[model samples]
Target: MTTVSEAILSRRSIRSFLDKPVPPDLISKIITQAARAPSGGNLQPWYVDIVTEDSHKRLLDLIQTKIASNPTGETKHYDFYPSDLPDKYTNRRRATGAGLYEAMGIAYDDKEARWDAMKLNWAFFGAPVGLFFSIDKFMGKNQWCHLGMLMQNISLLAIENGLATCMQEAWAVYSDTMHEFLNLPEERIFYCGMALGYEDKNAPVNKFITKRENITEFVSFID
Candidate 1:
């Protein structure tokens, strides 16, 4: 059995997935385990919906038209990053993006290639399963944090089971489309999407793992 530490170290935002299908039963099992994640007041905030098989195809077909007409996508329902993000955060984001493109052998000046790569987010990077996460619109940041804990649990559990996942905030752009397709009520606000499946071992985009800051960078000792 894989240890918690192994799952933590091995997990990455997998951008490439194999064509293999993940059984619906396995997906349900991982979600059941993630339900154990701690939540404030046990509100659990997160509402998860998944797409696989024929449903997945239907979603892609619906979105493809929107993609062709407005490749830039709709206005994001929530901010993925602050409008005036600090240099520290900006630097880290840039570093990660650079490493990602480098792994894909995409040149920095190649605008078309970069956009092509970015578009992959809409297709969930070819992952066989896509998970949509949402929370009540009235919830505060605390509840949002709780939702994140749930997602983290899902990520870790997925790794332990030989599945990889990529948390795609890009899905926020088509919030209305997704809400309509999923037949979800307006009270629930779409937050993010996660691509889940077996990794494509030979894909270049999955070749590099992003870096993490040392504990000293953000942690402090009370002593």
Candidate 2:
């Protein structure tokens, strides 16, 4: 049995995946365990819709059509990032992106390659299973934070089960398409989605590893 600490350390945002299918039984276990993640007041404002292969193909086709028309992804009801992020946040985002692109031998000025890579988000990065997470429109900031915890738990659980996943905020670009296909209720709004499956060992994109700041950078002691 894998320990929690082990899962935390091993988990990474795997960008490459095998075409193999993930067994339903293991998928069930990971999600069931992830549901144990704590939520504020136990509100558990989260709904994960495991996509079927047929639906996956349909969504892929929709994304392809959109990309052909507009290389940039769609806009969302809520902003994905701050209009003006502080230096600390901005630097981190840049560093992670640069590292990932560099791993793929894509120069900073390579617009074509960059756009192609961005399209992978719509393709679920080749993962066989895609998960769409939704929450009620009435949910507050606290519930939103809870949803993040749920996402992290699910990602970590996949690691423990020898599976890889990428929690994709990029999927929000297809929110309307996703909502209609998932038949989401009127009150529910799409938060984000994820791609789940076996990692493709040979993909260069998976080699990117962004650095993390030391504990002192953000941690403080009350004493």
Candidate 3:
């Protein structure tokens, strides 16, 4: 059995998945377990819309159509990053992106290739299951933090079950289209999407692992 630390360390944002199907029952079990994640005042602000089989195909089709008609992408409902990212954040982001492109053998100047690679997010990176997370627009930042806890729980649980997951915030760019397709209530705004399934072990993109700052970089202990 995998220990908690082992599971956490092994989890990665898998970008490529195999054609293998994940049983709905297993997905249900993982999410149910993840529901144990704590929420402020037990509000449980997170809601997930699971997509699989035909529904998955339909969502992907619509996303492709929208992308083709509007290649520039849609406006995000929330700011995923600051308007002017601090040097620390920007440097890390650039480094991670560069590492991924390098792993995939994509040239730094290859805009077309980069865009094509990014489009794969809508395709769920060929995962058998996709999940859309949402929260009420009225929720505060604390609620959003709770949602993050829930997602982290799901990711860790997935790793324990021999499944891989990728949390795709890029989906927020197509929030309107997804909301319409998923028939989500107006009050519930999209937060992010997740791809879940067995990893495509042979994929070059899967080999890329981003660097993480040491604990000392972001942690402090006072005696």
Candidate 4:
């Protein structure tokens, strides 16, 4: 019986997962609960595509092939981050990456090792369940924000159900390929992917805890 606050505090971007399969019924229940997340005008702009077992294998193979043929990756349908990240944002990003690499004993200069570790993302970090999120191409930035709320809800609900998740914008680089493989309509644009399952608690990468700014840093109160 995890409280919402506890779930929020405990949830992490789990990069490694155990081999255990998540029951479809459980996934259904999670989604049903997460759907309660609010959207402006109740547009409910997010659409999810679930991959598991054999279908997951097929999607992984297709992604691997694409990666091998075009190691640089494809153009994303939407930008996940700012093109010119300011110093404040870039500094935080570097710190998080450095921490993760240190946890895994990957040296800062080891580019090859880093690339190898990143390749595991295509495999969903061995999670038994993978989810792809998409939205209609016509949706604007407000709808995109709505999608984020839905995703956060799913992540928190997952923690309540003894599951862990990693939201991967890296999947956006393969948007075109995924669109074709999933047979989604041309008007639907891939937003992001999520890995879901029980975390590999013993993995070194799983132990990395990223830092967050103090509440005062971003909050403002006017009398």
lDDT scores of the candidates, listed in order: 0.92, 0.87, 0.93, 0.92
* lDDT of residue 188 for candidate 2: 93
Instruction: Give me the runs in candidate 2 sitting further than 4 Å from their true place.
Output: none
Model 4 misplacement above 4 A: none
Ranking by TM-score: 4, 3, 1, 2
Off by over 4 Å in 1: none
For each candidate, what TM-score against the reference?
A: 0.97, 0.95, 0.98, 0.98
lDDT (10s digit) by residue, model 2, range 76-164 = 76788999999999999988889899988999889889988888888889998999999999999989888888889989888878899
TM-score, structure 3 vs. true = 0.98
Residue lDDT tens for model 3, 1-223? 7789998888888999999999999999999999999998999999999999999998988999999998776877998889999899999999989998998899988999999999999999999999999999999999999999999999999988999999999999898998998899999889899999999999999998878899999899998
The number of clashing residue pairs in each candidate reads 0, 0, 0, 0
- What candidate 3 gets wrong by more than 4 Å, as runs, is none
Model 4 weakest 10-residue run by lDDT? 71-80
**Strongest candidate by lDDT:** 3
Residue 222 deviation, candidate 3, in Å? 1.7
TM-score of predicted model 1?
0.97
| Pick by lDDT: 2 or 4, better one | 4
Better of 1 and 3 by lDDT: 3
Residue 188 displacement in candidate 1 (angstroms): 1.1
lDDT of 1 by residue, 1-223 (tens): 8899999999899999999999999999999999998888988888999999999999989888888998877877888888998999999999998999899999878999999998899999999999999999999999998899889999999998999999999888888888898888989899889999999989988889888999999999997
Query: What C-alpha RMSD separates each model from the true structure?
Result: 0.9, 1.3, 0.9, 0.8
Worst 10 residues of 2 by lDDT: 69-78
